[model samples]
Target: MRCFMLHIACLCIASSLCAIGDDIDEAMRKSVPPQLKFLRVYGGDDESMPPIALTSRPTNLRRPNIPFNFSHVTIELDIQSPTPPQMFVVFSHCNADWSEHDNSFLNDPALLRTSSIDWRIAPPASVWYSYTGTLKIPNEHVKFNFGGNWKAKFYLYDDPQIPIAIAHFFVVDPRVETRLEVSGDFYSPRNTVYSSGAYTIDANVRSVDGMNDGQLNTAVFYRLNRYEEPFIVSDISSYEDVNQRTHAYPLQTMLAGFGMTGRRFRIERIPAENEYRVLNLADYSLFPRSNAPLRMLTPDLWRNGSFFEKSDGGFMNTRFIATGDRDYIQLEFLLNTQLIQAEREVFVSGSFNNWKPDPSWLMKWDEETKLYRLRQWVPRGRHSYLYMTGEVDADNRKAIRLTSEEFEGNTARAGHTFIGLIYYREFGMGGFDSIVGVAGGSVYGSW
Candidate 1:
């Protein structure tokens, strides 16, 4: 009945999500993760951490803010034992229906693979063993049926009667900043919109492993393209002494594509020779459209605006703009839903403010503009912002859903990813915003 119980739980989550509205946003905000969400896990039978356990045995690593459909993931776990032990990990999503095209594969039932991890034999209960493994998750999506929801499970089968351990896994919602589409509006501490300004763009170049964050040898490579070719910004945003996460680069030097949303800049460990070797990613923006709902995919930079010390010192500018068209800038989303607003000081910071989310730098209300704003003129340059919502998912039970694949006749399959390139180009003004009009939304649950 474990499988049935889990299935029931997912269904309840799906139903709760569909019923949510502005009238209930307050009640739902506390229990659910913002945006769409999902959940799953694996480990020993400890059950302390539903999705994980504290054991030397192989376990799956947990990640947040992955796009719904196109977010491809391959989780690997290493195991060493005198005898091999049974294992399983749950990969689930939520929706009214969880069937694939042929109805043979369970859409969000569980993640299954023949070759996931190999285990070394261990002594029965007497010997303790462990294995090291990794999960390779790509920004890819899969769905069997034309339109439906299904979670999956990946595990080691010990026997038909019982199993070793299962890691609980689930899909989750992405935050506003984590949204792959639509750049938010830039705001200052005074709650003002700085549509025009010499902005600062901080270039943070590093591997996911953080191994080569070494003193970035004197030069920093920057490529900026407003949805087109990458322009190499060499010998810019350098520091007298190299720092860890980011290196500040000024935008005044940028020839074009400033203040545009699709503008993408990659900070590479390698400095360019002539200019960037730009590759076409269909639309060629920093973030890929393959993952819907969460558009505007500028990696590494925080959604809230960043802050720095001003040369003048009178006003501390916590917000900035892209310095070109005014489309790409720091935007803030205040959760003043009369629910979670009073308890928190929603602020911004991250790769934006060197990882500092300062309350002092938080935006204030602009009585004149009738909007919250954070504006100051420290130094005009292109810099990243860390948009802070200061709010958690309404409930951990809700999941963030993304359009993973295109089905036959718009009928989706089990693990098919749609080429969103064509669909994205046709988006009208406030391109990503138009997504709200979509009638069909994927239901999901969060951890």
Candidate 2:
């Protein structure tokens, strides 16, 4: 029975493997349920909301590009209900395009590792529970000797087939170095508030492996910090061979600039003390192990991308220490806004929500109080957040998508991190795009 299942898994990858578009999307939606959310696989400490606090990190950024490292990667999930369920995580190696590699199951029959997870009951303030699973890649049992994309699927430990959650991660043996520089309008000097942010990238791509030169088709992808999607330069410009070992693909593209005027006259900055207001329902704080409604938190203004360092009562640079004693803390977020125009929605986005506009973070306007309110149950720690309002796409099923710079005003002083990725598709490879190299840097506008 085990051999039959192995053969089936191999066949699925070899044929339907790495298939994108509708097939892959449908498969992912069917495999993972929606209620099991905020699934992440990160390295270092697992206690932080975002294990890696880099805002410029890729949405798909799961693991550092180092392969066969000793660092442990942890997977975590939040179930909306307090009931603890029997969960198991299964790890699999996949090609760059995220399909099961053909040789994965055949060569290493033990390529798939399954481990059970114990769910911890969250604090009384939270309506949900948290489940954490950790795995050290290249440990005694599993060694990811190769570089590529990988996946971890969570399922019932007893059934082990119905996937409840899924996460995609990357393991890279970086054979190349990608250096990027931004030249134009690094600082917003022209305007006091609305800076017409125009910039281009100066890139130097070097490959240690001689085979990765201008001879192959290479592309560069870049994005501003906190944005969900990236802009792609499909056909890079000025592709030249600088030397035998290095290739220069100098490229630049326009970035979206922020506007000066909006519903809120100017970007409001709240006092440092009030930022990331903490709610302690523990035995010492207000409501202890009781269902009493906590006090209403004071409303805070837009932070303008200011992060709360772990030292300043924030979670940054610190790891979450699970005591199995603290209850969940519920904090209310408010945006002072009169009447939101029609077809517009407000969201509070940050590293906590992967910097994306999730429905859970959407704030509803309270007419009586005249504030957009959101009650979120966050793990104990400080966090940074930004308020964003965008138009709801009526034609596209009323999808709420944010526009660059309009809602989240980007100032010259606002720190922005840009990550440059270079993907190389060698001649005659029917497989996925291998991330040859990656480079990232932070830029602040100078007026």
Candidate 3:
């Protein structure tokens, strides 16, 4: 009788544990927002670019305003509920490395947070999302007084402490002159074929206000349309380097040179990867609106050393569809790997996800078909993407070091834009790092 009673007790405990697990799963599901996107609008174009802007100021006699030079970004997202929830956006100023600034001069919380997002019902055909919300920065509700890396945190009005989504953008108040140069001369640790395509980038920054050279000791380089990750170079040494993994040079001594009011930052052996592959979904006749997921007409074949098809650097084009007609479609991507085998896990990176290789985009290898397949719901547009192979970093699971060179060949002729941002340490207002200049150049032409 005692044994039977103990067995009943074990069953009871098991049932309680299962109930707890269900509750936890439901909570996690509710915590995640359906979809959130931070987009920079260039005039009437809806294509994606780095969400960067110059600090706004009134026109003056000395510097007359230029036509079509306005810079601001919009935050768009979908809320799952039919009734719009009370959402708020809070802004914070960040250092060059993206760490939040603690000083009030750099970040004033009271003036930086707002709950004035415009919400509207999703299109009639949209099924996954119910309502859409949009908020533009530097609007009447909030303004960016300081320039640097900025973070926008979205939160529910009731639960102000926790953020449901976060977006990053940059505000630059150009106070220095900057120049960037790219050349096809560099050395790589890889073999001859890989080394042949390596390029070197040199960014020269000179202070216009006669600032000390030591104050202009930091700078960062980014490939256009790939703003989430940057190669940061700084002279400051700390016990723990925050950007050790993404540093342009392994050591500070590798910096090109320093002058009275000028600093040069150089990064060599950067692979000139071939132009991105294009996935055009703008033709409504070819890709009609449908309830079922649509598969590509042809499977993507593995390209090792071959290159074809010209493409936009890494931008998404959504201007073809009208504002009311814009919608998301479920896309099935298949990569044929019958000719070669993958040594590491494969993922699809594209402008849709800001070229981020998140685990959700991981392609599953099908043994029966010898293909890597991934089904994702992407907005209707033309997107540029690449197939990458890499593992997640052990130290930081969120940081993945994926490369496309193994599948996508590299060539110097492939035009790519490199943007350089000059960082200066301002000793005023308790001292904070700020972007004083911005410049960009392309290997084949001007960006």
Candidate 4:
């Protein structure tokens, strides 16, 4: 009956999603390919901090925005375990477009063999027990001779078909210099009726290497912050220069919606530290599921667009312990949705679920309590989460269209970051896309 109850619950939410509107069908079809599921995944230059529990890397290390060879970034993975199985990480090459490329570069022996990976057993830690694996590109076992797009797939060593986790990274040769200019604007230029905020991107590329033909055979890819999908442009007319070394592509329409800000609540904050305010998710016993709509954590003081600033002000804290053991907390999330009349579905999302709107995280409406609620075995740690609403498209997947702004309001202050990259492909000679330029930055916004 438990399985049947869950199925009914999913159907109810899925039905609500499909009923939202006609436009959502196209939006859902455009959903980017999902990443492989894993307990934890991290990537960055060799010198960056390793992935740990109870925390998320503030900036994505996988899509490095720095001007360096794509081979410079390394990926690390920690697979969740009951009894861990042997696993190996494999790399797949992609074209300037994110589609998989059927080129010989991926068939190289160095990448085909298991010797390229440096596997290690995770140190006994307070949060959870699992095996960790590392793969550094351009290592002795495998080297990325040419660059385009690369995805590292983790699979069982003995059974390659059984996959584990997946990560995306980049490599660049920097043959061209690219400049990006971003401006904030209303969603529509003519009217401000439903205005939140939008970004207009203008890009310019110039040949940095005298031998290169520059923007003539290049594609520019731009993404807002860490989003997986990229806005791409590749037209000779977009180039401002005829010698073809320089090109400019301006946004015809502003990218709509105020980018959702980071989570304001700190579930992982240490209690003894007077400066930090946090909800203690350690004791499920204290908060049991009851008829009176068990008031879960204290009524959250909605702080729109607020972010944490630790003493060190570093990207993440290395010394903080997020959880005590492998045991999970049966935490219930409660949100008052009485004022919300739209036929949209709501979800709780954060770094734990790769910032994606997951079905498991979907919240159900309670007619009696006039609230949306979900119960899950969440591990104790500092969790960053946002209350977002959207439809579960025909794909049965959730894509956000409305955030907590209904209650939280639009006047939240938060930081927004953007990353830009330029890719090039020569006419002949294996025709692989190579990175030529990179740039990234953050902007602060209120309302």
Candidate 5:
């Protein structure tokens, strides 16, 4: 009898500990303030352009390029604190894969950080966010000496060690002429049936005066608006392979040919996902200022194999919003699966989150309502998003590989902007990866 009572007492203690753990998790989630929401980097003149900088004037005027000036890679964010938050920006020169460069010549640690940020209070009617912050790099405090992938980390002035937010951008000192071509005659190796309408991208790099053909053996591609995710194709097979534990396909390289002048890299079996679903919050009548959470008027339905609407190529537009109307709204998203349950985790990804499938954006399955629901705070703008289904990468908790076809569908007619970057393994300053060439083109257009 005493043993039985002890067992019951032990179970009660375990239950209490589990309850405490649950409460702690909930508290941590609640502690994530909206101050770090919607951190974005774009061109100074045009927010639609990618966050890429060109250090030199283009010699070939006809080729498509990342047109933004080196000083115009602007970082914009919103802070919801009562008073302005003391924020600082630190710039890190990164390798082709975004790892920080250790060389002092490439990454000058002393001159790459700043505590200056332009802050403005929100309009009187703005309730969700209190302040807006903007910072343009290559400014007075910081400058870029090397051309490569870059990351701008935002940190609180008090807590300088840990970054609260990070934004990816590019600085290019173009040395080669790159041409990009997109073809639709490709299929995924792992999932051929679902990816029957995949696209193939070929990046042809022509060596210029300063380029070394042997070192230029790698190319990375991005679906313009989804800059955070890169499709890397390298001469080294191991560099192209994905993490074995992740739900991602091995590097989809069709060819990587070396030539006397330059190199040609081809990445095939790229899923041509359907056009993005747009969420317009600029219309005051449709999305009026509300003290309570605003729910999507209509629940999102799954588009298994159908797409009709034209999209903005995943660009977020805030030009139509009034000055006073620019504020964050508590938006509720409801995805009605029509009683069909998802086999993997479902997440809503968009330009708002840099197209990343963050666990915070995960949808909860409602058995009673037979719907997937998520409530999030979003800014007032015209945004594009998609419903994604995939598992969180076990190796990298911050990364996830999602398939749009499982919920959004795939189509050959869907237009996408592709950016191809040529990487050269520069041997100067103990070796660093440099982007020597850049090309941009649309799936339905010429390079």
Candidate 6:
């Protein structure tokens, strides 16, 4: 009787496997390849929210590029809508009175052209019912610890089952589930009313990954130094821009710049609940000249604010003399391994080169330095940049799509050789979110 029961159990297991295999086979057989394929790209593996970039450094920036005060986003769908009866899901962020991020995702200037941008999918239909989509984020832009506001919607045309169910998902950045550290120092003080000084200020930002990536956007605040008050004055300091982590990074190329002589100083974190949240201290007399290399926050405080020992956390108190003469600008950036000959081609293009792609700035293989590099006396503090690698071969004349290629997801070696990122199965979604990614690292930046 025991042997008979065992045989029955084996048969059940075999049947389930056979069913799964049959479903895949049938789905492909009936489904006709649609003209276009909907693709979602992000740095990390979070399907719901933003993607966290696991790739060590910033990879090659794709065609549509990264611009200051703005980001380029794109998503292609393979649904059966003829005109694709457009519908949109949005997160209307009040980032700068809603200017930089305008209501214009529908007008993607660089839409994938015919044939070149393959829209092939299995089985085309007249209408899409239960559709699914993916969201991509930059490497820097991460979610808040307790979750933040990220608006999303679903726009399906002519579908009676679900016409326009604008789904709103407000959840924390993926890091909340683990032990994540988000800390930084302020170049200037946050609430003091004071004039500018001959001091240099900068901050370092980072995230938790197999490789180190310290880059983020920080909201810096300035006020009069005399009376510790949040200065509402319209001085240059008051109208200064924010700071980023990747100093002189290709994303911007240079760090952030803040050159002003305000009476006092202070910096504020932006976006999250801590935006403009004043740094906590018993008195405003915390700014003093110390010869020691200042440790911003105590280990425990930075690690996880301790038992009120110094728990009122905000910006780490980092300041320089208020002498209003020196280059007060600060350049912050993230450093990933430099590009190699095997990975990408180098080209120098910009207004400096008559808006032409110059060969001089073309990266040279630094055998000695062991890195591909281009050095320029960038603006003192911070700036943005782009790394363009023109088309390579005939088939890959445009962007390389690993998803198009059928590889078993083995792009690298753990113990042996250092293989590049999986180029085949990994869908290379074009947009700022495709390469380094905007989420989970730094969302915004200014200079």
TM-score sort, best first: 5, 3, 4, 2, 1, 6
Per-candidate Cα lDDT values, in order, are 0.25, 0.45, 0.70, 0.45, 0.76, 0.24
Model 5 Cα shift for residue 315 (angstroms): 1.9
- State TM-scores per candidate: 0.23, 0.61, 0.83, 0.62, 0.86, 0.20
lDDT of 5 by residue, 1-447 (tens): 999999999999999999999999878755654466567877655778878776533434453344334455888887776677887777787877676656777666567888788888888876667788888877767767667888888888767788878889888777777888888754553444454467788988877664458788678888877876778888655446532222255446754455455678888777777788988888878888875799999999988547767767787788878766688778999998778777788999887777886788899998888889999888889898999887776665544767787777777677678888888887877787777788877677745
Task: State in Å the error of residue 30, model 6.
Answer: 28
Candidate 6 residues 1-447, lDDT tens each? 999999999999999999999998878744543222222322123222221223222232221111111222223233433332344333322121111233233223123011112222222221231123333332133221111222233443333234243222222222101111122322221212211111111222222232122212222221111011111111232122222210111111122323221111222322111111122222225422222222213211110111122211211222332212111111111111333242345442221221123344454556764544554311111111223343223541322111100001111110110000000111222211111111111112221
Cα error, residue 356 of model 4, in Å, equals 2.0
- Candidate 3 — what's its lDDT? 0.70
Q: Which candidate has the highest TM-score of all?
A: 5
Model 1 per-residue lDDT at 190? 20
Compared with the true structure, what per-residue lDDT tens digits does model 3 show for residues 1-447? 999999999999999999999999888866765445323222212345556766665212232222213367766666675367778888888878777768888678788989888888867897666677777777787877556788889888777788877877777766766777877754342344332465677777776656676678677777787876676667765411644554222323235555675778876666676678898889887788875899988889876545678777787787677867667788999998755666677889887777766777888988888778999877778888988776766664543656666667676777678877777777887887777777778776433
Worst 10 residues of 5 by lDDT: 242-251
lDDT of 1 by residue, 211-324 (tens): 122212221121111101121332223321222212222122221122222222222221111111111122324422221222223212211112222121111121332212
Total clashing residue pairs per candidate? Answer: 126, 5, 0, 4, 0, 80
Record all residue pairs in model 4 with backbone atoms less than 3 Å apart, i.e. clashing: 70-170, 70-171, 70-172, 268-382
**Which scores higher on TM-score, 4 or 5?**
5
> Comparing 1 and 2 by TM-score, which wins?
2
Evaluate model 1: give its TM-score: 0.23
Ranking according to lDDT, highest score first: 5, 3, 4, 2, 1, 6
**Compared with the true structure, what per-residue lDDT tens digits does model 4 show for residues 331-424?**
6777764445434677765434544566788888777777777875554444445565555545636454334443332221232344556666
- In model 3, where is the ten-residue run with the lowest total lDDT? 59-68
User: lDDT tens digits, residues 1-447, model 2?
Assistant: 999999999988777655656687777655653356454455444433211212121223343342223144555666643235666556665533334755533225455565545465554544444443344443455555444446777776556667877765544445555556644343332234333343444445555545435432343333432223333443333321211111111223332212221000010111111123232333334334433334444565443323343222222222333455434445576665435332357776654554555567777878788777888765443444556655444553322444323233443233344555455553343344455555554344211
The per-residue C-alpha lDDT of model 2 at residue 119 equals 61
